[model samples]
Target: MPRNSKRSTSIRFRIARSTVNYFRLIYQTFNLDIFELNPTASYPEFEKGLLATLKPYRRPHAFLPRTLGFAAAIARSAKSVFENARPIPFNANQPLFVASTTNQKLAIRPIFDEMTTDSFWFDEQCKECVSTHANRLRIPFIPLVMLKALLSKGYRRKSFRHSVATYCEIHGTYLAFRLAFASSRPSCIVISNDHSAFFRTLEQAARHSNIPTIYVQHACVAEHFPPLNFDYALLDGQDAAEKYANKASRSKVFLVGISKYSKSENESRWTGSPKRIGLCCNALDQTASTIEIITTIQKSLPDFEIHLRLHPSTPASEVDKLIRKCPAGSVVRNDAKTVNSFAFCKSVDVIICGPSSMMLEAAMAETPVITVETDSNTDVYGFQKHGLCQTATSAHDLSNLIADIETRDRGAFRKAISYFCEGFNSPSRPQASSLAATLIENISNRQQIPTNWKQSKKHGWWRYSSNEPELEAETTA
Candidate 1:
């Protein structure tokens, strides 16, 4: 007994948990956010700190812009300082509920429409959001004194300025939502993304009101996403489900396929030999590096033309910057969001991009994708590790990779993209929206609440068990 007592009895947590707690502890200590609060906005800051530690160059931003935005937001909220707490503007008792992002409005629209006609939905409290769209709903902003206290506590150290400002926003917004939900009493909350601190705050307030939450996968998943802790999660396929489970997801998972996309025939663009290269760029991409990747590839493949597809959300000035700096062979096109995505994917022989869900979309379109890493740092989705696509580290590496694939059959290069999404090519399969809508409706009705992972004998629809540990069955000797 004495010999065995030498070992430590203290509990040990996983590395990721320890890392998150480290950042959370920093927030608590500096902001004095004890007893009086629980915060969710610290997630992004944790990510910034972790990423900066992992990749030194991508450090927490320089002081210039962060300070400006912090000051601006504080000043902007002053106008609403006299405003009183407002309730959600709706005819009281409608609880068959859901919430979505303004950016994802188009994708979520069909799902919402399937849920009900003439439903009034609201976006997050961002000033940029229209607040009221198709059927407008305005949620009132409530004034709070916590901002002043947080701001005062923040000036103790100039370096913690950004963190203090971020907390003020999160706490303030959370109180407003809490005030609203306490009165509204919605039975459940459904959301498309959890990465946003505001969304996480909404979930917190909903839980405070004893309301259940549902999550739908709106974009690609990676190792860095927060754990899936919603009451229910409708995932795209096994890839997303497994990733969520590994992250210790607490939800009852469902593989409802990609709710936004439907089966369609892609336009044929390849004729005789391959000629065009489509480079996809969105707001999330690093501009200088993406431009460098495209420019280098243009010079390498002189025989082929390059087309740059700028996402719709990209700024008007970005078009000018890309066009002026890029090689003459590169043509910048800004209508990517306006046109059909599948058709645009088919317009190129091979697609080149950084880590984005577009790689999976290209696979659905049956187009070959080459994911350019440019360095060891930014492969956020691990496409190469998953064998989902071919990765190139530098311009020279990318150019050589392109040369080898330029003449190869497109069919041979296509990766198994179905692992991330389900039932895209098969027209006979039911669409993800209808299935998701039915499930949502049933959940709202409090009927057939499932306990474990099971599949429908009829269509093989996934019904997951919340208690099943993802890898409980597998044990190594």
Candidate 2:
């Protein structure tokens, strides 16, 4: 071919690759994932992490097929999506989406149930819930969005491919909700999941439509959690407020204590040396380590009765595996999922835990929780630094900590709770659910934000009040 003809063909190929798919993928990747950047890191470190994706060589072309394939699968999965889901819109009377976990559903319900506004419990299937009002969120689809996203570019690294696939999946998610919002608009949306793709899509859609978004803290967070960008956020305590403070300017943060609990419901501490111990493990823990933790504890504290509690996500097979691995003198139980965490806290004098939000929950219940690193030494929740719990590096360390806990006055835990929680639900103040529900109702009515939530003029963060009780004196480990 002539040089001119060859050059023309190359230009066409490049242009073909630069269609809507490539641009949208790049744009949304930056727009959405920027929030996921670590706020706790210093300026230079933060800048480096944020710009990693946007490096001149990322190409971003390989993302097209993954996004297109996902979008096509979604479209094909529900042949009559328009009939069963796509045409559907938000709950007309009270728009609520429960796209999070069963536990989050439990955390969010108390506040949602308090609202006179019509809302419904939603599971992943988009089925009509059994609420007094038949609340249903009709799944809606927008073909154009997916079509545009599928329009063309083509590969690089495996890790990069997986990351792009996830980001593209959210595009498909965002498009469906975008169409749904246009169908029948609601006054506001309430959510408890900030970490999920679906919930984040709904949040992004709601913001685009100028609809108010309310976030209730269903669980504890890490330093890596996205900033509080919701229009209204009901936080569990000061720990959360501080973690998200750097990026929370746009969000109105209410330091409502954990909404799931009502009144000061604490476990009754034993008057003498502890007679029972609970060993709790989450999915993050390895079975070998779990067995070792329990066996070591049993050997170290031979007189104490030990109960093993597996997380809800633990499979039945895993449970059986755990039971078989239990030490001869120890008792293995998987009933922790059936009973509430607070109830589990009450069942034992002290808890030896893996990295879980339950550490804080158990602490709030006045249960002495000792965290042990089962899989890795990483302190995911900062329980030890915050003074809520004692950290044990090994099974032996935990055994010694258990003995110390026997002699230590449990009142020292009260100060730790203050650092994390405004207060356990109490008669002295409104419950977190009530405060959050009132705020939601007021916002729905287009009324002024209640004066009780004050924004700091200096830092621009909102707080329910600064009248929190002073921290009790620090106790030695």
Index of the highest-lDDT prediction: 2
Q: Which ten contiguous residues of candidate 1 have the minimum total lDDT?
A: 130-139
Expressed as tens digits, the lDDT of each residue in 80-160 for candidate 2 is 333434344356546564646767887788888888877655554543211101112211223432343345233213222
lDDT of 2: 0.64
**Error in Å for residue 469 of model 1:** 26
Clash numbers, per candidate: 3, 5
**Candidate 1 segments exceeding 4 Å error:** 1-78, 81-87, 91-103, 116-119, 123-160, 265-272, 282-303, 311-315, 335-343, 393-415, 424-427, 449-477
List of clashing residue pairs for candidate 2: 61-154, 62-154, 85-139, 86-140, 263-425
List model 1 lDDT by residue over 1-477, tens digit each. Answer: 454453332223355676775565344324433112322223444345325333443324466655664555566466444454344554233443345543455455667667743333564442222111101111111122234434543323333334444444555555555545545655566777666655666666566556777788877776656686678888888777776666666787788777767655544333455677778886666778777887787677778777788777777787778778776646646377577666778877778876677777776676667876644346565566656678787778978877766454443333245457654434455677867776776666677844433676654347433342332221112
For residue 264, what is the lDDT in candidate 1?
A: 53
RMSD of 1: 13.3
Error of 1 at 423 (Å): 3.4
